[model samples]
Target: MSQLMSIDTFLDSEEVLVDVRTPSEFLKAHIPKALNIPLLTDQERAEVGTLYRHKGKEKAVLKGLDLVGPKMSDIVRSFLEVAPKRTVRLYCWRGGQRSQSVAWLLEQAGFKAKILKDGYKSFRRWVLNHFEREYQFRVLGGYTGVGKSDLLQILENKGAQVLDLEKEAHHRGSAFGGIGLPKQPSTQHYENKLAMRLRAFDMRLPIWLEDESRLVGKCAVPEFLFQQISRAQLFVVCRTIEERIVRLCQLYGVEQKQSLIDACMRIKKRLGLEHTKKAISLIEAGLLDEATLIILKYYDKKYQYSIDKRVVSLYLNGSEMSDVQLAERLLNR
Candidate 1:
């Protein structure tokens, strides 16, 4: 049997990753390019945790064994179905009991299975470390509704290097951002897509990307890319509130009036019910300008607050430049 390998080693190999974490945990987040094949159901894991805390370790282990014993054949079959024919690497939360058990089973069945040394935890740590390190990046920061995506498209059209993070994640990255958008890709798919894009870029020139959170919809940015964005120089696009609202309306389409209202309602607690009510009334009255003013004051402030927290160095408000000039400057910079 081959010795267990560290996540970094496993990452470099041409092997398929078998993630044995709970589905919910996998859904919330996971290592980039990892495929999930949970050894325990969400409820089963919860039951085991409760038993461990309230009962005892022995009792929890016994219960876990009881649950897994009957399902062993089914689990093995399921894993084989998705696993590649070549080398296979397996991991759970830690490289402790679950992954070891699975790897042992595979080895006994005459299949080569390499266990991850520190499991998913180690891979997550690696990701965080890589992200915290410095990397060169060019950020696209713009006020809400400034058509940053359009600008990205224009840049791409002009043959400039770009990474459309939102497009890769299949999310627009806002509260009402998901409306009219396709279902977001899995984190694994997001990383695969992003990797391809990164490979396509000329390493000599800096990469350009929009400012985004670590998680976009259901997908997560890979650790290295996330870190790169965090340290990268920023360029802000500024536009008038009215102009922004017009751009947003165009992006979302006028048919999303209800989505807009529902989004406003969801934030009622933060914006205050009175303010939300006024915003809703403006929308209902077909006074888009009035509704936009309220939303801009409220939502725009939130956007600015997030920007303040991130604190990237270079800032350019798009309100001052024409779109063509902005595109040229972004490409040249």
Candidate 2:
């Protein structure tokens, strides 16, 4: 027999999750870690939907059965290959016939199945609602190359709750952020990942996050969470120009020179014609430190303006302390 479970109970269970939506639907967004065992190909789903619209539910049902009939054995086999135990959790777009049909088939094969109530739609609602609740956030603010991310890792190593937004977004929160990083997830997928991480930390404890603009690369922080980040107290870190230049060099030096030049050109208007040319020339010449220094002048001014708008809780001289020392100080305060 198959069971229908609420989103919370479904998520909390140890059973492996299987998504039975079309491949296109699964690609758009899904619960993290759920295996995609698409019930229909994209074309097939479109055909069924078109039939449902033009002919009616009865014809569509027959068409769907005709499409799924030969694939039933493959579907069960696919699940068997991935299933660690005899129990599994399944979901579709809206707790519709697809998931129900899959669950019934798996049950007949001697497997226990649980379905997500309201399917992936319910999980999305849960994710969006999660951002509305309050969380204790400690926003780390600094100009470019102040080692903010490095310090956050240190803080986490020492047992402080940290939410690495840039890591989640696969971006460094700069024009050059995507130079050598993996392709970023869609904004919907990004939110799903962020919400999952946010859920792991205790609401009562401070969750440290790097100060970010509304958009991190291509991903927008969910509005409610972004508002919370905007209002939270900021702990700013500062470093001298020379120290910052060295840090930036260390971070981007290994990336291809052309990639660095392309990144600089992306902000040409803001960086100004002469500055952009000079930075590109410096990068091609392999003077990464000098190139970074030129870039920082523009970034510093922009960051200072943003900092002025925030209510800073404190400022620490990053140049004077080790990352570990800074982490310790933030935790102690």
Candidate 3:
């Protein structure tokens, strides 16, 4: 018979792991590196759940078995193809029924299938706990056009440990975030990339991270990292709107002018069609200052909202210091 182990134990072992949760559940979140092989088709899983609630567990279980029985051979074959040659760990939502059933079937087929005791819920708890541990962080906070990315490049040159969350998420973290960026990773891939980055950092030193939201582009930030950002200390950079507008224009350049115009136009309903139209005219007329002023009110308010809601510690921008000096104070503070 195959053994059942806690999620921690399974993770500790040098073996492949499979997550048997439905694709939707797996997409929202899952153990890093676990392959998904759902026991039920999405529709069938919904139907069984509906039956279980309206009818009875006995009826649902019977129907579930009937649905899965005919596909058992194919499921086993697919599992064999993905499962490690030596040993494999399997888990479902709670480790009681679905995972155990799958493990027993795999064991009967002469494979070492270890079920994750307490399953994915337990693993999620572990991820949450890890984030609660006290770790130093070097925050990168700036206004919409302060050239934080460029500063990050300088910081990297100076050998500071940094995690470019925007780069990793393939998002710029704004209404125009998707412009000039690759397609965003799925939420699962985002979490996996985050975990990989965190693992590479030295826990003793501060890890540099940009100010970001719970969602970057199409992907939601992992629950753990979201919590960290909420509690982590912050450093703010300031620059004149003119400096920012020039930098934005240079960074985005002519290639993205039409896309920028479209992004501004889409905001018409929110900013009022009159105001949005004026902003568009400013862009078209090369009156970037006018366009920037209008956008600043909208974007600045949004930034303030996040800071207030997330309970971030604010460091006001210094007027006297140079950008490099401002960055140093923020990082060292």
The number of the candidate with the highest lDDT is: 2
Q: Give per-residue CA lDDT, model 1, range 116-210, as digits (tens).
A: 88877786666545434344578888776887788878887888788899998888876666777788877765665666456556777766788
lDDT of 3 at 233: 80
Over 4 Å off, model 3: 50-59, 84-86, 150-170, 180-202, 213-233, 238-243, 250-262, 265-275, 282-294, 297-333
Report the C-alpha lDDT of model 2 over 1-333, residue by residue, as the tens digit: 899999989988988989999888888888999899988999999999999999999999999999999989998899989994778999999998999999998888889999999999999999999999999999999989889999999999999899888998899989999878999888998999988888888898999999999999999999999999999989999889888888888888889999999999999999999999999999889998888888989999999999888889999998788888988999998
Model 1 lowest lDDT segment of ten: 127-136
Cα deviation at 243, candidate 1, in Å, is 4.4
Overall lDDT per candidate, in order of appearance:
0.76, 0.92, 0.76
**Which residue pairs collide in model 2, if any?**
none
Which candidate model has the greater TM-score, 2 or 3? 2
Q: Write the per-residue lDDT of candidate 3 for residues 1-333, one digit (tens) a residue.
A: 778887567777767778888888787767777888888877888999999999999999999999989988887888879864836888898887788888877776778988888887777666655555666776767778887876676676677788888888888887777888888877766765676566657899887778888888788876766777767787667777777778877766554568878888767777778788888898888776778779877887777777665544655564566667655655565
What's model 3's TM-score? 0.70
Q: Candidate 2: where are CA atoms >4 Å away?
A: none
What's the CA error at residue 6 for candidate 2, in Å? 0.8
- Candidate 2 to truth, TM: 0.98
